[model samples]
Target: MSINPTESCLDCGTPLELTIAGQKKKPCPKCGAYRRKREYQ
Candidate 1:
């Protein structure tokens, strides 16, 4: 099986493969790390 690194948590390095529940925007399940917005070109 292949794991997507982008789906991992940034803070505690936990797996964040699941999407936020109903757009509630919950924190990481393992480390409780919140998601941050990023800017791209």
Candidate 2:
């Protein structure tokens, strides 16, 4: 299954974008990191 690099967050509905690391990141740069962390755990 392929992923959309420009999609929104499934949980918070925040728009997403590609990061320098090639990961889909949240629209809110600050909350993005926290959200990803919470998602993994």
Candidate 3:
């Protein structure tokens, strides 16, 4: 399956591009803190 090419931060809801596979978390460029993927609901 293919993951979404981009995801938003769970905390700040900031959208980030997925550069690597299996990445669960990423540092928010705006907040400067780590954020996890939000559930698809």
- The most accurate candidate by lDDT is 3
Lowest-scoring 10 consecutive residues by lDDT in candidate 3?
A: 32-41
Off by over 4 Å in 1: 1-6, 20-22, 36-41
lDDT of each: 0.60, 0.46, 0.66
**lDDT, candidate 3, at 13:** 82
- What does candidate 1's lDDT look like per residue over 7-36, in tens digits? 556687665655554876668888788864
Candidate numbers sorted by lDDT from highest down: 3, 1, 2
Ranking by TM-score: 3, 1, 2
3 in model 1: Cα distance from truth in Å? 13
Error of 2 at 13 (Å): 0.3
Instruction: Give a tens-digit lDDT track for model 2, residues 1-41.
Output: 65435544555656555355765443554354334312211
Candidate 1 residue pairs in backbone clash: none
* Pairwise TM-score winner, candidates 2 and 3: 3
